[model samples]
Target: MPNNGCVAVNDSTFELHLKKPFQPLLGLLSMPYAYVVPHEAIEYFGNDFRKNPVGTGPFILKYWREGEGLVMRRNSNYFEFDHKGVRLPYLEAISISFIIDKQSEFLAFLLGNIDFISGVHSSSKDELITRAGALNPKYRESIKMITGPYLNTEYLGFLIDTSLQHVSNSPIGNPYVRKAIAYGFDRDRMMLYLRSNLGYPAHSGLIPKGMPGFTDSLKGYSYNPDLAKFMLAQAGYPNGKGLDPISLSTTEDYVDICEFLQHQLSEIGIPISIEVIPGAAYREMMSSSKLLFFRGSWVADYADAENYLALLYSGNFSPSGPNYTHFSNDKFDRLYRKSLLQSDDSLRYSYYLKMDSLALDYSPIIPMYYDKVVRFVGSDVEGMNPNPMNLLMLKRVKKIKNDTYSR
Candidate 1:
């Protein structure tokens, strides 16, 4: 391992080092030896094999049995201490068991097996809420249900490919075709059906509402089948007779949304073919640009308009690039560059608004709805804070003696 962290290593060098058996093993153990491990067990494991760990965290890894559970013990040698001079992580041990089945996980929670459960799935939200409410009023106060707005936003994206290109050298590049598609669907009605008024209808912009630089005045498309048919016919796909069947791909979670879109588009004379694939396969197909239209969601890596705008319209493509729609506009790109260079937040926000306006006008991808992060925590756990980014901060959390206790 290189002692100096400033220098960059090429891909070939990384691959070569990774392939060396003992080198990779040593690399995994090196962090602990440096006292950088977050838990004690990690270091202990490294030391048992003649390697050493330098981790100084509150917990130490004790045992890990594959397909069973992981056990971590509180580390007395942990560097941090409370104001009263007591060691952190008051609990003696922490155990994590992988329960792939969510229903089983809920049952375990009911049986008092786990201290906390993060990410309550959308399908189980109603049932979980109802059950939690039905408990004794005193018990309900102890059992915390953390809910917050999340940065994640879901959308339907159109794939630009050679098959859809026309001889005008522009092909399916016509903005009218994109606009017609956007207008064909009834987003609000769909949200009511699928999410039960929990979601907001999408406008034709890349920056979702509630984020900085988002504008309600720049609404791009609304539910108007008549207008959609007119635009499609104007784009020369009258009654959808000559146009090829449009394919909409999605994962199982969004199949219902796709089906609703399929029905709505049918009303506008646009035949849509639904392709429901596994999540991993769907992502692979999307990256390969094999699917014409697909469903995707973006969870913000940071709280910035640039994070959302740059990903979808920056004229760049991925692994780090998020221009999944392959949308390119010189005006938007120029504004984005200018915004990044500006040091002042207000100036940057002004440029962001301009960029957002341009993106809405172009109508590349159809925005869906922003998501919410929901979770259920046990009655004994306290000081658990949930952030809008969907991160659970449990460093200050401690188990209480009983349901009535609070810290």
Candidate 2:
């Protein structure tokens, strides 16, 4: 294991010997990867907690059965309290079912068998939400809809590594060509029709909506068929005459979206082919640098700009790192490294903006949309707080009896 730039000074205190003055301490706190475990329990837990788990959280694992469900009981000794000094974890027990099909999960939610239904499925969206992207009037009284920005950015990555360039489609390595493709698609229409407005059209940089450094002013490529044609000519592929068919690699879940993109790009003379692979195989191909054009999403690991920017960092190339597109620019690399060391809060944000601008200029990836988290809960369920990270804090969640509605 690598050193964490931190050292124990005493039993109760520790010091972080950082490589830079600016430390992402707040971001670190929210990451499970940065968690510290009880060292003394290694022997007792056999270096694993598959069966016997331990935590100081608000719930305790009580029962788990394979292919069925799991149950957790509230921790009576939980240390949190409400403003009125009431104990946290108002609910006595929580149950989780291992349902594979999303339709089944939706049915369970409709039947009042679950406390909440989040990440609304496409199949159920029309039934639960109106075409105008509001909760259906019929279910509005019984279901409480909570919607907010989630820290996730979906994009299409372009392989900038010239080594992966095919003799037939050399234009894929050109920034202008990439920008042309970016400008050819209609993100607003996709969000409205395909996603049912579940997300915001990505008009910003790679940084998603609701993140600390995200800004609306960081301009992104929008739909413009004429500009796309001009860009293709500028990239030395007049009317996409010399360009070969661009193949896009993605999973089954996103095939429809890719197909839509293919149709839109074809109007600008860019022939596109859609390849739908299994999720696991698609990931493997991406990690192995086998796919040149692909779909990817970045969900914040720590709600920081660095988490998303790291994907474009040259040092983080795939197989060993997250830079699947193999995008590398010396200026981007220098600016990113400098951003990590700035101590001043305002200056650090400026550095973040500069790096984001560099990404926008290069067009290594086409920003699609920033995902929104949606949750529907029964009226009886209360005290739930919706956050950008979509973290579930069951400590304050509770279910109450209502004679008017059956549950």
Candidate 3:
């Protein structure tokens, strides 16, 4: 086993010898944080290393004009090669523009100024995709839309730890209240109307759709206004008679979704006020456990369901780990440890399901929807593939003009 997570045996050689086999290490290694950094680059760049990065990748940073654009040229001596033994990164250069408005970005792509655009903003979503979640027929010849499951679960969290003063007094501290909030809103409608069906309704659990360990065994909370009313009455706030307004902290980007929730929950006796905080400050407050109720998303750092489940593990309490809700259970912790050490696939997944069901029973978080990676590509480009992580791999991408295709 590594003394401190890893060991360097010699020059050009590094190894991780685990005492007990950990299956998710492979997924963890694929993350950017796992990249090997050269000591020379760190020593030379110091605090400015972000501006002056040095790494062994497919492309070299050519130029970056702050708030404008950045350019990268292909690395001729890149280590990776194709099956036919040709060096990769066939594209000569990669250009990226810092266009703030997605509407303007779509215009530039239509004018053939950019190769591709990712994600559809509300400003341009209706123009490109119909309510049925299909691209408009008018763009069939010039544009292409690619979409798939993204490994992200957006949700609303609660500070369930009774040790916190606000949590003890707040109505959200009541489990029935949380469950009522979960059942009050229509997640399917949220996806259909707000997202244009770009995402899957997260009715299963926090695992999200298309991700491993996600199961329907629990048949999670669906939109049931009647049941929501029942739960509110059980919580001693029938028709919102005695319930106080619960503030939902969020950023400007999610105000629409929050507003949608605000209106829906209000109908079933739970009044919610939207507190639109600046992005960075909101994140800081969320991590510090200052916000009793807040909107957050867990984008998997790896491909495994363990990455998502870690957010609920008691040992990972913030501001240390991702356990923002401070939910703790003995059986859950036992299952988590077992799953982490278990090497068998079926057994590990079973443990995952059990843990997720337990968390749902507690209702510390309200699942919104599993995100989807939507892409808009120009006909002039090819060789791009969408993945759950939304990674941008430009190695084999090529551009076409007239009768010739150029990389």
Name the best candidate (by lDDT).
3
Cα lDDT for residue 119, candidate 1: 64
Q: Which stretches of candidate 3 lie over 4 Å from their true place?
A: 1-5, 10-12, 17-23, 37-56, 60-87, 100-103, 216-218, 238-241, 401-407
Q: Write the per-residue lDDT of candidate 1 for residues 1-407, one digit (tens) a residue.
A: 55433223552232223322221132233332333323345545764532333344677778877678878788877767678987776778888898888888877776677767876555455656543223234547546776656777788776653344531343246667777888899888886677654546776466665565666777667898888988898888887768777777899988888889889888888888898899888887777656657788887655676777866554666434667667777778878777766767688778877876776667667787767656667867777776656654444678777745541
lDDT of 2 by residue, 142-199 (tens): 8888888999999999878876645225667888888899999999999988888889
Count residue pairs with overlapping backbones in model 3. Answer: 0
Count of steric clashes across candidates, in order: 8, 0, 0
lDDT of 1: 0.67
On the 0 to 100 scale, the lDDT of residue 340 in model 3 is 84
Candidates' RMSD to native: 8.0, 2.7, 3.5
Superposition TM-score, candidate 3 onto the true structure = 0.86
lDDT of model 3, residue 102: 80
Per-residue lDDT value at 294 in model 1 = 78
User: Ranking by lDDT, best first?
Assistant: 3, 2, 1
lDDT of 3 by residue, 320-379 (tens): 988999999999999998898888888999998988888889989888899999998887
Question: For model 1, which pairs clash?
Answer: 32-53, 32-54, 33-54, 35-54, 40-60, 41-60, 41-61, 166-171
